[model samples]
Target: MSLKVEFDEPKCVAAGQCVMVAPDLFDQRDEDGVAIVLDDSPSPDQYDEAREAAAVCPAAAIRLVEG
Candidate 1:
């Protein structure tokens, strides 16, 4: 199985939790502090961190799908 990351920009609140949990997989735009996904499909080694990032997202803008 593999993981997929999705971000709904309109729902983002610039909380930065995702970035804090997984800096290598997520980032924010300098223009407006909106989240900018760095990796949509992270390696297996990063799955835990990526999952945590999605969990910690206050805005609930991050979605993780495994298939």
Candidate 2:
């Protein structure tokens, strides 16, 4: 199983939910605080945390695609 993480910068509200949930998978930009994708393809161990990040995101900026 393979998973992909995608972040929408324009929709980011700097809520920091993604970072709080999955620090290794997502990060905030120093300049704008918009969430950035750290690892597009995460390992199986990170799938749950990645899902939590997306679920906790207030701006709904994080997206998960599994293939």
Candidate 3:
């Protein structure tokens, strides 16, 4: 199974929860503080962290899709 991380920039509320949970996969822009997806396709071992990041996002901007 492969995991993909999707981020909705428009829906993001500049919350850093995703980055806090999964720094390797998520980040915040230096200027606006909007969440940035560092890795859209995460490794299998990082699947749990990816899911956690999505779950912790207050803005519901993060999504994990399995393909």
Per residue, candidate 1 scores C-alpha lDDT tens digits across 1-67 of 8999998999999989899999999999998898999999999999999999989999899999999
**Candidate no. 3 TM-score:** 0.95
45 Cα displacement, candidate 2 (Å): 0.5
What TM-score against the true fold does each predicted structure earn? 0.96, 0.94, 0.95
Q: For all the candidates, what are their Cα RMSDs to the real structure? A: 0.6, 0.8, 0.7
- lDDT by residue (tens digit), candidate 2, 1-67: 8999988889999989999989999888899888888898999999999999999999888889999
TM-score of 1: 0.96
Please identify model 1 stretches exceeding 4 Å from their true place. Answer: none
Runs with alpha carbons beyond 4 Å of true place in candidate 3: none
Candidate 3, residue 34: how far the Cα is off, in Å: 0.2
The lDDT, on a scale of 0 to 1, for candidate 2 is 0.90
Better of 2 and 3 by lDDT: 2
Candidate numbers, best TM-score first, in rank order: 1, 3, 2
Local distance difference test, per candidate?
A: 0.93, 0.90, 0.89
**Residue-by-residue lDDT tens digits, candidate 3, 1-67:** 8988888899999979988889999889999999888899999889989999888888889888898
